[model samples]
Target: MERKYLYLDYLTCIGCETCETVCDFIHDGSPHIRIYVTENKQYLPINCKHCDDAPCVRVCPTHAIYRDEDGAVRIHEDKCIGCLACLQVCPYGVPFYSLKVRAITKCDMCADRREEGLEPACALMCPAEAIQYGPLVMVLELVNERRAKNIPEHRRELGEEELRKSVSSGYVLL
Candidate 1:
């Protein structure tokens, strides 16, 4: 079983937030994934980094955080005290307090979906095909191919000035 990775093509994202929406719909709360709008108008989609040397797994006092067999850094909610220790240790701050489940949780690569041989909702539903999910090499290859063509670069709209201004308003941290 090859470890899978998710890649977001910044240039291809339309900032529709569909990925985030789908995740929240399934998870029934705030997203485990997020889309950030950069000052340069790039959309940055972020999820768990699933580091080989994961700090969360090492630092969890209750041993709640662990790497799944599929290479996702996952939280064992039953063991979590919601101490937020995982958040502190995470460089990317991927885990979040989920009121819906009353625990800290992060992406498990949509484990149930993956077990059924399905891609994560974010990657599957992205209209722009910005989020690629698969084995690391395949994901990188797809993203690089698109980048080479400069495909789906953000475009200026002649109309909808107000909407554009509102959407492009502020600088967001990646």
Candidate 2:
């Protein structure tokens, strides 16, 4: 299966946070996507990068965190022992101990929704279309369309390096 990707353009994001609300509603109150405000006052959308070599998958001693058939990094709730290994290793800080589920939970890119032929709530609900979900090439084209518009020069390019430069780009997760 061709891997689908989710991308965000910070420039077009109006910071309305409808994504967070929809995510919570869909996921039984545990939001997998978070919107953070940087020191520069930009709305930084943080979710799982689901890296090619996922550190969380490597560090999980219990094998609870693993990549699914669709290539999304997922936590097997039944196998999780609350070791906090995945939490420590994830660069985006996407995983968190959910008191409700009693396990480390992160985004699965709305897998259940996908099974029913729906895109992720965040990307679908984003009013400005800042968040995009589709084939990587198509998404990247959409990203490049807004390349130099209303963006700070340093962050004008947030391609595949989005995860790597997140912190240095002045996004502080609160």
Q: For candidate 2, what is the TM-score?
A: 0.78
TM-scores, all candidates, are: 0.74, 0.78
lDDT (CA) per prediction: 0.77, 0.79
lDDT of 2 at 120: 86
Show pairs that collide, candidate 2: none
Compared with the true structure, what per-residue lDDT tens digits does model 2 show for residues 18-86? 888899898877788888898987767788977889999999999998876666788899999998988
Residue 170 of model 1, lDDT score: 36
In model 2, the runs with Cα more than 4 Å from the true position are 39-41, 148-174
Q: Write down the worst ten-residue block by lDDT for model 2.
A: 165-174
Residue 157 displacement (Å), model 2: 21
Candidate 1: which pairs clash? none
> What lDDT is obtained when candidate 1 is compared to the true structure?
0.77
